[model samples]
Target: MVKPVNVGIVGCGAISAAYTTTIARLAGLRLTAVADLDAARARATAEANGTRALSVAELLADPDVDIVLNLTIPAAHADVALAAIAAGKDVYGEKPLATTKAEALQVLQAADTAGARLGCAPDTVLGTGVQTARWYVDNGLIGRPVAATAIMNHPGHERWHPNPDFYYTPGGGPLFDMGPYYITALITLLGPVSKVIGAASRTRSERTIVTGPRAGTTVPVTTDSHVTGILIHDSGALSTLVMSFDSAATRAPNIELHGEQATLHLPDPNHFDGEIHAHPVGGTWTSLPTRAGYQDAARGYGLADLTTTPPTQLPRTSAALALHVLDIMESLLTSTTTGQATALTTTCDRPPPVPLGPLEPRTE
Candidate 1:
């Protein structure tokens, strides 16, 4: 039997709960410690998960931690990842990799120099929902991919979140916040993007908080609330993207891929699983069977998948892919400003598809 990898998590925020729960259930991973800027929160999380709570420095230095599961906010992702790599530990971090391409590049470089493996989230792709779609695409069910559309629209997060000020800030807008899921899924299904054209808008300068103690208080908007982009893939396929916080609702399927023979309506990339429907040129829509991806997967399955990967292999959620996803997003925003199509500076091969099965055999 393979030994379980030890995981030490930093950042005991809401996302940490998901990781802790996932790590507990995965046979190949063990949660050994947790840390946060808020020591009390860390202690509470540690106690809840039956793990130790240590200072960030202590957690990074601990020899028992084989991987640092970084759940820090966007601003801190690169710093935490670099520190973990410097400490000779592999890292798996939450999405976007970093707020800026430069910071993400730095983290990638540091990990390379340290010979540490680095992975990032939006691992939802590894689940059946998106992976099943990849299976069909890879099998040529779509028959010569032509184009695709990805749409994510909602009013905003302030409606429920207590302190939603960050949503209106530079790194908190819809594109940076939710675009990762859609864009990453697009890349996964279609392949890497080569160039992009973009346009964006901000509906209002200020928004009122609708719930929590901060209800009625207004937060300033510093970022675009509606972002649209045209991505030209290396395969000559084009993907249209719409990520918005300005819309009250949208009835559009989360994503759709058009090909020579049919169009595939994919489930939400934000979720682990859902129904995928296909419409042929002369036939009615039909559901595709769940044919790929980790069964009953969730947030941290990517990390678990990383633990089981051979040392010389890149995990499906490798940092290189995350960095390319980040670069695509950042470049889109830059294109919105420059009013010119932007060529991507980075790219990654499509991650290998997950075959239909559980991540590992269930223990009786």
Candidate 2:
């Protein structure tokens, strides 16, 4: 029998509930404890999830924790991850890895030196929605891929989140906050990017909070609210990307891939599953059956997947990939400032595709 891997989460913020819920459902993982800078928040999360609450230091030093799930805000991701690695625990965390490429590199280096495995989120690509789309691309159902477009647009999060100040900070802009999903999905389908040309803008200096106790209050915007980029892939595929917090809505599909033979319409990479449509050169649009990825997966499935990875293999959501993704995003932001195309200083192999199945096989 496979013994479940023990998990201790650091950071009991809005995203902690999803990780705790996911751990409860997966057979290969167990939530043993949780921690946060806020003592009360950690205690509350532990009570709700039937686990122990500890200070951030105690949780990292806990012997039972095989992997520390870093769910802290973007600015603090690297610090928490480095601390976990120093404590001799492996780590899996939410997306972007860190606020900057330099910080992400430090986390990767620390993990490498400690001989600890590292992984990061935006694992939605491992789900049926994006994976099914990858299936078509890989099987040549879409022929030689020529180009792709990915877009994520919404009015700012200030209207909904009680604390939306982070969204406007250096690490909270549209590209950093949401670009991981799109860029990671694009890399999964078209391969690593070689270069990028970017442009960005901010709609306002401050945004008023419309909901929550902070309603009617305003937060400063220190980062771009709208960002557009053109990624030149090593495979010779050109992918245009738009990530914006300024737009209220858009009619564009979340993603689309054009090939020699057909065009594929993909569901949102932020979701685990959705419909995929295809249009042949002279044919009408048609739906494709789900053909790959973990069935009914969620946020923590990547951590579960990491738990089962062999010693010689990198997890699908490996930190190397996250670092490369971070480098691309940071470079894009740099391009916006220099008004020049920037070549990526880093790249990673595409992750192994997930076979269509449950995270853990069911027994009859």
- Quote the RMSD, in angstroms, for model 2: 1.6
Off by over 4 Å in 1: 361-364
- Specify the poorest-scoring 10-residue window by lDDT in model 2: 355-364
Instruction: Give the clashing pairs for model 2.
Output: none
Which ten contiguous residues of candidate 1 have the minimum total lDDT? 355-364
lDDT of 1 by residue, 272-313 (tens): 999899998999999999999999999999998887777788
How far in Å is the alpha carbon of 299 misplaced in model 2? 0.8
- Expressed as tens digits, the lDDT of each residue in 183-267 for candidate 2 is 9999999999999999999989999999998899999999999999999999999999999999989999999999999999999
